[model samples]
Target: MKLESNLPKQSPWLYTAPLLNTILLLLVYFLFTSDFVVQSGISVEHPESNSRLTGFDRAHIITVAAGTDSALYFDGLRISQPELREKLKANREGERRAIIHADKHAPHGRVIEIGNMALDLGYEVAYSTVPPKS
Candidate 1:
């Protein structure tokens, strides 16, 4: 009798309104943006600087693979410099950003070339870095 009185007959979901709201908000956040997932072929040897990024959400991802040689890849599609620029120009009419994932041992010149090209296309460049191994 005491237990029955203590337990309300209302909907269980109603009892957890605050918790439900929090979970709903989190779901919406993750759905709207890619926050915790990383997609790249970069190695575990990026030089870390004292720089901190403000917001690096779903920016355009360009991977420069160093398997056989230096090759330009946009979202896994092989593209030339001019093609890359054209694609960027089409997709990015407003402010946009780019993330470059280069091999750890890739030549600096190649990486810089890609960075310069992205900058020339009016996209902010961000280098993908990994935490140093302990």
Candidate 2:
């Protein structure tokens, strides 16, 4: 006796379902775990440099900007030199490091002043520069 089959055979595409699902899951995981550093509100025209940064953590960021007014911004908030000093003094208890994003047009003295303050507060200071042009 011959058996009658009514349902259509499964599509070949079904074979790749597991693989597609696995790839999508991995993509999502990597997207979330990737180190994505968002710069604070201060916009800076960073000076180009051949030097590369290594082992840098941007948890604490300071932005030195120049234009109508030269100012120091900490975590996106405009702050005075004394305020910055106080901040570093308090943060000294924890990680003693800061990533300074100083505008290329900013006064050289201001950048130096900030770095000195950080050093005085016992912080290992790091400067952020744009990658050299190809």
TM-score of each: 0.63, 0.81
Clashes of 1: 0
Clashes of each: 0, 0
Q: What is the C-alpha lDDT of each candidate?
A: 0.77, 0.85
Local lDDT at 68 for model 2: 53
lDDT per residue as tens, model 1, 1-134: 45446665888788799998999999999897875676754443466556567576778778776655777778667887778888888975654888888877777888899899889878899998766555
Clashing pairs in 1: none
In terms of TM-score, which candidate is strongest? 2
Scanning candidate 2 in windows of ten residues, the lowest lDDT window is 51-60
Candidate 1 residue runs with Cα over 4 Å from true position: 1-35, 41-51
Candidate 2 — which pairs collide?
A: none
